[model samples]
Target chain A: MDYKQLQGRLRSNILKMHHGAGSGHIGCSLSCIDIMAAILKFKNEADTFILSKGHAATALYTILNETGAIPDEDLGTFYKNATTLPAHPAPLKYAAIPFATGSLGHGLPLATGIAKANKLKGNDKISFVLMSDGETNEGTSWEAAHFAVANKLDNLIAFVDCNGLQGFGNTADILGNTASPKLWEAMGFEVVECDGHDIEALMQAWKKLAANKNGKPKMVVASTVKGKGIKEMEDKMEWHYLPMTDAQYTAAKQEIRAGYGLEND
Target chain B: MRKHFSEYIERNLADREDFVFITGDLGYNALEGVAKKMGPRFINAGVAEQNMIGVAAGMASQGFQVLCYSIAPFVVYRCLEQMRNDVCFHNLPVYIAGNGGGYGYGIMGSSHHAIEDIATLSGLPNMQCYIPGFVEDMRATMDEMFARRRPAYLRLGLGKNLPADMQLVTGGTQTVLTPEARLTILSQGPVTNNLIAALAKSDKQNSIDVFTLNTMPFVTLPAALATSIATTKNILVIEEHISIGGLGSSLALLVNEAGLPLDKFISLHAEGYPNGLYGSQAYHQQVSGLGEENILRVINSYF
Candidate 1:
């Protein structure tokens, strides 16, 4: 598969969704798009993925649309009143979303439990959870980390989208070194660092983690720009909250096309 | 109550392979047998209640009947959002067993008291709160929780043994005495034990009726309890929990909806740290006006 082309398509869909809704975590969704794409490509039917940082539901919904897990019309209903695709993910609203996780710090513990259950049931299912760097500030994340290590959940893999920015400001300035690889390693996870937007790097990281049978939960600390892909929006705190204006949307589309060499599209 | 809960799990583990128990570093002597039998299936989730609840929700999503156990405050107050969003919203088969409901952890101060657990938990969508009023009611409560296969809260506390003559009505509502009395004293949890003891010694027991409500967020008033309330226009609602959103509030709504006339209604509930003093459970009950003497005083006032 042409991952660069796929990334452009996902970026376009995500921007369109946010633009249509007139509200969403556009930058936050942008930061984790490639990570989601990588996991979707690598994971099997036995595996389960939980979007713990639920503010970025648009990103997950866009990817689910690409996979045909949800109909295109359902994707159109994102962020509308009483829509299944709310600003945060609702459990069983879509086939792939197993838990309602818009609240930060919830996904890791849930992932640990799923991994533990799979181990007890003698199933070789890997539980994957995607979280934001800001979400690590929640105490439950550390608690889950300790539990995952204590129980030796080798079947669990965590992805931290280190976007550097959060709702307030830069994550480091707010909560210093919250989701660092060192912290995860100290918490007993086998940690891997990579460029989050580089789909190949994420894929390689996933491969390394999945190959290990070392009874330690795995973490991928993917360094990423908060508003990746769009030149003006990348790493800007304002993009996290701002929906695109018509002019901004036009410019962003051009940038995405030019960046991925999809001028024809 | 904790012993009965442990016994229920130990007894049912043989037939229920899908059962998984997770505790938030509680159950010192009571759950050791459960741990031994279930092995890896039994999880001591450290002292992290939030993580424990989230874990329970996750396991439940995978078709396991998961139970998360801890002290009432630790389990209910600490991870309320997880309980609401993860467990209840999904309608997962995750049972939260909270020991020491209301002022059961007396002398430990307000932090240990779960005075509002019933209201907070019962308010959530797709969640049922069960307060087993007697030691014998634990098995039936657990059975109902599992049979329903949804999110539930089991509040465990100090409960008296049921006297041989008295029988628990269907749905665990028991009418201890005087079914057609002019005044109906509707109580919840182990607090009903104090009411029963108070009524047994009272010379005017025949003038007042006593009914214990164990399950909360009831869809409708239990048939017999409704009949009693309808016949007896005067009602006294008692609970260890706070007056708001507890049995008192719920029953009041149900009674009004059922169009049962009420000449007078009174609610006696946990007053919290009235004097900011920590003491035994009995002492707290006394201070909160939930003791046997005060209960009898209120029952007698109706006459």
Candidate 2:
């Protein structure tokens, strides 16, 4: 699959699904598609992934569909009451998802326990936890980070889609973001910075961390625009989850297709 | 009866396989040596209470007996939601062990005291609580509970008047000191001993019966020598916890629901927020009082 081409399809699919479901963090969902797709193809582990930021579940389901983890037809059931894809992503809906995470700062702690459990049981399945910048402020996140470091959870890797915006406003404004890198570093873990929109960079960073057996947990901070690939909504918090009208949907879909050179396909 | 539960917990080092203990920064010297002995079973989850509960829930989900330990307000109040949704909702066995219960940290002021712990905790569904009246009860609870129930919360006193040995701690039985009396002084935890002492001093010890309840959740309400409330016409419920959902309120509900018509019943319990940042043991004594002296006074007034 073409990196940019697949991203375009995922982007349109997310917008349609979120709008159809009338729920979700639409902007963040569109921003993190590349990282999700690249991990599925490159990581080559039992392919364990958990969406720590449960609000952006549209992006998760879209990528799952692209990887044939879910049928494209079931995408319509995104957030319906009877549907498996409720407002927060339920792992039981898809085998690839190892756990459910929507309660802020929960994913890392649960993942840390799962990782520690796996180590005790002598399993090497890598648990890739995809989180949001907003979730870092929860004490549980840091607590789990320290646990992961103390226990030397090399089988675990965390990806922070640093989109900079949360529900209330800028993360920096709500809580100063100066000491996160320093805090984690002091806890004895390696850190990496990458462009979230650049699938090749994310895939490469993951590959490097996979080779390091030094027994330290790894964190990759990927800077991203909330609405990447959708020019009209880029960085606009107003589109955080504002439903796209049918006309707006047509226009946005057309623009997404044109952006990735799929106007005629 | 002064039973130091730490000694028992220290002996059962390998039991941690099914038991996971998480703590705040406290009990550093006290718990560290034995905890580290558990190797992978022990975790100092830092001062994050909310996260600690969630981590315990995670461990429980994976088949580990998890115990999240901290001070009362830290574990009971700061992380109430996590306690409710994660631990309680799943009905998993996660023990919440809190230090400085009641006036244990009275010198530490209202902030450290845990007067309302039972009031708040007992209200939750499937939450079994224990306020060990003496060290013997603590030893028995720690020993028997591991093989029986996996999850519970234990409020430990400040080691002031612990049971000198295991004599008083029975295998889940409410110890009876007096029988068939007009006044029944019902209570639990460290404060309960103080009440019995008060009775001994008053010489009304013969007239007043004392029952020490170590078993909790009020489910195992001891079938005592039931004095007909219609004949005695009096039952005084006392505890270190708040009168609200504490021992008094629990008994009241059971009695009222069963329609046990007692002529007079009084709850000699606490009032006010015990979370005083002020440091002093006197603060707890002032707020909750030491024991049955105040309760006896209330019961005498009723007579």
Candidate 3:
């Protein structure tokens, strides 16, 4: 299947995984699926991206499975005791992952360090770091921002998944919302805006902005509804982690299977 | 120690590629010439202490030996968790230089005073705490700290310069007032000088040995030295930090760990200040009972 088909299937699978576990950040994870797909398509490399905002791993693990980073049997044991896929998406819990996740605002600076090492060692592989809009509340994020721009680390790309909700409450109430696009622009980044769910649009933006190898860092402000696929989940804060019930799970599966024409697993 | 350590930084920059000097956007006015000579290795991480520490940690992970410069509290307390987790957890052979210890920033008020650092730092595990007394001790401790690829906290003083060849280092003991008394007094950094001067003014014919603890995580205080100190009716611990969790306490813990006996453990620590202003490096000792008179009083109390 093409990238678009894979992206859609992954979004559907994210909800299904969260259904099995009875818990997940379905909304935020669903929105970032397409963005992850776009970057994977553009980079065309073996090393995988790391989710700095690890809370969104429900969807991330789902995509990793769809891409064969995890086998179908392995996906069944997510978040269970003795299972590698703990709640916050520990990287390489499965073979293909890179590093552990969960603590937000850490991945970009780390990725920048990795990129710098590659540059010094004369390696051409790239690393991507994805974070939620709420993770920007940390000063370390700004510190990393300044360092990356100043250091001229061009190989690193960071995505601020602008789902607009933080753990404590709404992002605006806690830190206040001003334009993120303008903020990144002032920080000396090549900032681009795109539909977070549109794999095609996101892929285009990634190629245009990030493909340039000559030392400018790129950030994509991916605007997306928190819960994208399921009917009641879109834009609902209640669905951030509260899982769909068995009845709701059966209903969701029926809807997904009906529309996609798949043999129900 | 300042001149010697600064000189080492100067020479290293000329010799090694990865060695770098980082400052707190303060206190290079004294070493302008050396800084100019060692331009590439020097980095001023600015007043943002936490950010500077994280930056240092990041740079260190890439095989750079980052010598972070700042006042004691700025280095130790303000970015405490970051220092503990990011720097020590990674064990990235970076050296931290705390220029003003205890009340070094005496004029700046309590905020600048690093009186609480020793308590917090000594327990961080796998790190060395160097509380240098004389300028020569600075070289001895720094030479060891820099040579080993481990994290270290160097608590320094803005005190007097010593003779160039003065050889007492981390491993060796010195004759500060020319050992005349049988009783021995042990202290580190500026406190050592203050303790010596206190004994002289008291005018007792003395054969006391003044051993400066240059390297900390002080291994079992030597048996001969412990016996010498035990022979004395008094053992005084003087530090410019808080009476709680400072040098005296560290020594006490070391003595306990070594199962050595102490006749007396006297601590001269914070008593606020003559003026309430913080970060006053000079008046710190006088105000906090680390002054010569107070130290003498603690010694005389035992006699």
Candidate 4:
């Protein structure tokens, strides 16, 4: 698959969604779009995915649209009043979304529980959860990590969008290196590190974790830059909460299309 | 109450494979039988209330009936957002059993108290609150919660069996003791025991009617209870919870909406740690005017 083209298209749609809604979290959404795109390829009919870092709902919505799981009309309603695609994912609003989560640290525990239920029911279905590095600050995330390991949920795969920048500041400065491989390793996860923006690298990391039959939950410490596709927003904390103006949206779309040599389209 | 819960689960486990019980490292001596019967289904979520609630929501989403067990404050307060978003927002059948409701955890300090739990839990959409007044009510409450199969909270406290002579009105409002009287006493949880004891000794007991509520966020006032409140005109609501959002507040709203006449309305609830002291459950109850004597005094004053 042309992941670069896919990332370009996903980022463009995400920008359009944010621009249309006058919403924020564009940077965090961009940071994790590639990771989400790659993970969706491995998700089977029986598998479930949870966006623990719910601020990135637009990214998930865009990707779901790309995969034909979400209709284009629904994508157009993003962040509007009573829209199915809200700023945060609403539970059962979309078939793919399993929980209504905007609160950080909730997704992993929820995913772990789903994985545990699958295990108890004697199924091989996997549960995937994507979380922001900043969300690790919540004690519930670590508690879930311990529970996942103690239960030996080998079918669970967790991805941390290590964009480093959070709402207030860099996660490194706030939590002092939340994406350290050793931290997840200490919690009994089979940790895999990857360049989060590189689709091929993300795919490889996911493959490695999914292939592991060891009785431990999997973690992908995806190193990424916040606001990855747009030059002006890249690695900037302000982009986490700033909706793109018309000029910025046009420029961002042009930049992504130009990067993929599809400017004319 | 905990023992009754354990026994109920143990009895139902053989038939319901969907029943999953998770404790926040609580139920030390009360849940052994359940853990033994459930095996892997019984999860000791290890003192992580937030994670426990989220986990319960997750499991419930997959067609499982999940029960999350812990002290009232630990299960209700610490994971309020989790309950709101993960469980209640989705309307999942995740039963949260909170032991030590209100001052039931007295002497353990204010941290262990659940004074505002009813208000918080009942306020959530698609959520129901059940506070069993007697040990026998456990099975019925659990059955109702499971039968409804939605987000519900079971507030557990000291269990008191209804006296043989006392009749239960049944339905939404369980009228434990209803004497022909001009004043009606509405109460909730085991604190109703104090009212029952107080009524037994009061010479004016024959002049008052006592009703206990097991379910909260009432969809509507039961016709029978509403009639009693409307006719009596003198209403007193007693609860182990704080003043706001408890049975008192709920009853007041229901009565006002129904246009029931209230010549006088009084609510006695948890006053909290005004003296900044912790002691036994009885001591806390006494301080909050939830004691047997205080209940008798309040009932007599209405006469």
Task: Give the lDDT of residue A101 in candidate 2.
Answer: 59
In model 3, which regions exceed 4 Å deviation? A4-51, A57-127, A198-204, A213-215, A227-233, A238-263, B1-3, B20-24, B27-47, B159-186, B202-209, B215-234, B257-263, B273-280
RMSD for each of the candidates: 1.5, 4.7, 4.9, 1.7
For candidate 4, the clash count comes to 0
Residue A157's lDDT within candidate 4 is 93
The per-residue C-alpha lDDT of model 1 at residue B286 equals 90
lDDT of 1 by residue, B29-98 (tens): 9998989998778889998899999888889888899999999998999899999988999999998999
After superposition, candidate 4 runs with Cα above 4 Å error: B170-180
TM-score of 2: 0.80
> Tens-digit lDDT track for model 3 on B138-182?
666677888887788988776454433234644545554443344
Could you say which candidate leads in DockQ?
4
lDDT of 4 by residue, A91-154 (tens): 7787788888898889999999999999999998889999999888889999899999999999
lDDT of each residue in B135-213, candidate 2, tens digit only: 5567766665665454567888743344332245343323344444577657677776666556555746556655666
lDDT of 1 by residue, A106-189 (tens): 999999889988988888899999999999999999999999999999999999999889889888799787899998998899
**2 or 3, greater by lDDT:** 2
Worst 10 residues of 3 chain B by lDDT: B161-170
Q: True interface contacts reproduced by each model, as a fraction?
A: 0.79, 0.34, 0.09, 0.88
Can you write out model 2's per-residue Cα lDDT over A21-115, one digit (the tens) per residue? 66647787877777787787676656467778888888888888887888977888777778878777764457766556567777787667666
lDDT at B127 for candidate 3? Answer: 80
What TM-score would candidate 3 get against the native?
0.79
Candidate 3 recovers what fraction of true contacts?
0.09
lDDT of 2: 0.70
Backbone atom clashes (below 3 Å) for every candidate = 0, 25, 21, 0
TM-score of each: 0.97, 0.80, 0.79, 0.97
Who wins the lDDT comparison?
A: 1
